[model samples]
Target: MADKPSTPLLDTVNSPAELRALPREDLRQLADELRSEMIDAVSVTGGHLGAGLGVVELTVALHTVFDTPHDRIIWDVGHQAYPHKILTGRRDRMRTLRQKDGLSGFTRRAESEYDPFGAGHSSTSISAGLGMAVASDHLGTPRNVIAVIGDGAMSAGMAYEAMNNAGAMDARLIVVLNDNDMSIAPPTGALRTYLAKLVSGPVYRGTREAAKAVVQKLPPFLHEPARKTEEFARSFFTGGTLFEELGFYYVGPLDGHNLDDLLPILENVRDAGAGPILVHVVTKKGKGYAPAENSADKYHGVSKFNVITGAQAKAPSNAPSYTSVFAETLIQEARDDERIVAVTAAMPSGTGLDKFAELFPNRIYDVGIAEQHAVTFAAGMATEGMKPFCAIYSTFLQRAYDQVVHDVAIQGLPVRFAIDRAGYVGADGPTHAGNYDNAYLGAIPGIVQMAAADEAELRHMVATAAAYDAGPIAFRYPRGDGMGVDMPERGAILPIGKGRIVRQGGTIALLSYGTRLGEVLAAADRLAALGLNPTVADARFLKPLDEELIARLAATHDVVISTEEGGLGGFGSHVATFLAANGLLDGKTRFRPLMIPDRFVEHASQADMYAEAGLDRTGIVNTALTTLGYDQAAMTAALAKI
Candidate 1:
């Protein structure tokens, strides 16, 4: 573990109440100490670093200015909520961030009262905060509802939709547009800070309200001109023309890092008589730490790192990552096909499309933080006879489910969905877990769904997705390094709806889907030692089920087990349905399906989560042994060996 930083002021303030108790002048020192403490905790825990570092002052200011737990502050996506977590009496538990049964990486409503809304996904703060504000009005318990969202989050249509509603409703809500990454409105130093304070203050707000009241009394002809003049003057200086048009009284692009600037502006907005207000505050991504500040992508996240050197500890891997393999394979496909284009929702690097962009700059489109737009945008390209590859994480694709169903699936567009981050994502927990794609996509008709069993299989799937221009086709792959397998010269397309039998055996048969084939093979070895030789088959395609291969396995073997790294209604359910329909499960062949359990698997190592889900080697072997009705005495001894 790295050496801990000294945080005397931070140590004193465990909660926002304690923070509010501190003198106004002592806040800058408190902010400094808070920054040091956050850096120290995250250095050990290894989570979202730069985002939290950027919002240290803002977190401090909010906690200091507002009555947190009473006054609702919703952090959008919660990338920058680590500091907020620390200040809200969770300082000691900060070390356990993102671990199993530990504090969540994002703001969870169950975790603390300070977190009014649970925010794991981006661009949801505004909508959620609006609901709370409306609720407060109804309950007659007035409290400030503040939604702190990054400027990048504003790219999503949901944010604007919420803003439009808030404006129409005229709800007493405060939106702090954390203008950090996006260059929406650059801060102009002291002048910008002054304007923000002036506009947010009672004097300016009262004057504006009075003028509006007087304008209402005037003739209907002059109202339009007066409103336009006032809007134009304010928006020109504050750069919030769009927000003003949406019915929000806009503040400034003030310095987010400056406690003095942020404190008064937030206070003004808090005490203001306006129905809805939007404050724009600008800050650096990696505000305090030099390493994150100097690094590219602002060192957004990191593994366990040395505090002094900012050197993250990465485990050495022999095999290439599934993402890189996809990128290389996609690049190869693009080289042959000019029509092949890639699209990502603000995740060029995450999807390995950054490398693709380097090779074919014109072919890659990164629609910022807009998954719904990204899906429909790719569908538009496919309509024009262009092969569009929509590379997105499985978790993020949930946002564009409607687009997948209506735009692409219903239209039968030949859009290739390169679904990354399938199965259990270790530290990101259930929110980021890509477990639903198999079931979600499987439910839709006229679409080809597949999962790669290994690195080489991934290459083939990429090739298969690229080659086929049928309806919509999707292939799922996990997050980490692939199983070390020999490289193929080029991926050759495999026959659809067919499975390959890896090992042929007698009584027991194991049919695996996706990466769980590796675990099934390992379980088969252990079963072989226990006087049971099982057949192992990799079911490559989830959709267009391998009817012939599956029937053969069921007819030949007495017991067949179907395993998948998905929920109940995924590959296993599909296999079970096929067996029941064909009367395959009526005779000697009894089938046992293994999949992720009904509940959400929390943050843990991939190996550990699979074990818990009963999809690992030990879990599979134990399941097979129990299903075969092994003697209790014999099973206990057999279990010890495996």
Candidate 2:
């Protein structure tokens, strides 16, 4: 455990009410203490560090200025909500963050009254806040609704959509644009560039105060013209005129770290009677910590670390991560294929495209936090005869499903979908889990869906996707390091809809997909010890499943167990459907599909989550033994031994 930081002011406040009671001048000290406490807690827990550090003062100011539980404050992306959580009643559970049965890494509505909206993925806060604002007005309980959205989140179309609607409706909503100039990666798109110009412009620095004073002093008729002139001049020099055109009353590129500036502005906005307003505040990603500020990514997400040195404590792994393998293999493939290009929705490093960008900078595109745009953009690229790989997290791909179905699948475009984090991602919890990708993508016709059994297989899958130019193809892989397999120098594209048998057996067969191959093999070894050798085969492609191999396995084996690291309606469901249609299961061939249960698995270690879902080696062994009519006592004893 990391040494606990002394937080005398923070210790006094257990809830937002206490924070609200504190003197305005004392808030600076409270903010410092709160930041220190958050750092210390996160040092032990290992979650989002930089975002929370950046918003310490902002979080403090918002809580102090507003009646939180009643006045809805929705945090966009929620990675920056750790300080908010601390300032609320969850300070005691700070050390238990992201753990099983603990506080979520992202803001969860069920967890707290203060978190009015749940969020994991970005760019929904404005919409949620608008809904709350409208609801409050309808209920006749006039409460302020503030949406704190990052500049990176503004890159998404949803933010603009909400903004346009809110502006049109003329609802009393406050949008605090937290412009840190960085998301998970340095933000992409024109908005970031515009914000950069706005921050650097002389008009923003010099005339903002003068313009505000002039507008205040002018008559009612002159106020509109004067404000318009100021807006036009600022737009000429900076670029906030677009926001004003959207009908939001735009105010300041204020220093977000300065509580003196943030508090007064927030109080004014809270008290003001007007339509939708946007307060643009500039903040550093890692404001207080020198080491975090000095780091390239501003130490955004971190593992448990040494607080004194700011060195994260990541466990050493000899194996390369699945993400790294994908990046390297894609790079190798791109070297040979000149038409091959990559696209990511603001996750260059998260998707391992940073490495790809380093080698082929021109070939890779970092589209901001816009998954829908990323998909359609890739489809457009594919239409132009370019091999476009739309690399996205499995969970995030859910956001672009309409595009995947309409643009890619309908058009039969050869857009390669490289899906990372294809299973239960630990710590991030159910919201970020890549559980539904297989099921969702499998439901779409004319799309080849594949899952890798191991790192080496991932290489082959990457090559397969790259080579596959017939239609849209997707390959899913898990979150962490590979199973220390010897990687090939170059990947060979495998035959479509093909699978390979690792071990041939008699009584039973284990058909595995994705990373569960290791567990299946382990279970097979355990079954071998019990004098029951089960056949193990890796079903590489889920869509065009190896029907021939599946038929033979079902016919020959007494029991067929299909296993995958995805939800119920995924690879296992597909296999079951194929077998049922073929009349393969009418005979003595008893079938069992092992997958993640219907319920959302909570935050836990990957191993623990798998065990809970009955997908681990022990679980597999137990399932196999029970399916083969082993007695309860015998099964329990066997499982205990395993």
Predicted structure with the largest lDDT when compared to the true one: 1
Q: What is the C-alpha lDDT of each candidate?
A: 0.90, 0.88
State the lDDT of candidate 2 residue by residue for 293-345, as single tens digits.
Answer: 88737388898988889988878899999999999999999999999999999
Off by over 4 Å in 1: 296-298
Per-residue alpha-carbon lDDT of model 1 for 432-539, expressed as tens digits? 999899899999999999899999999999999888988999999999998899989789898887889999898999999999988999999999998899999999
lDDT of 2: 0.88
Score candidate 2 by TM-score against the native: 0.93
- Which 10-residue span in candidate 1 carries the lowest summed lDDT? 295-304
Q: List the residue pairs that clash in candidate 1.
A: none
Q: How far in Å is the alpha carbon of 289 misplaced in model 1?
A: 0.8
Cα-based RMSD of the predictions, in order? Answer: 1.2, 4.9
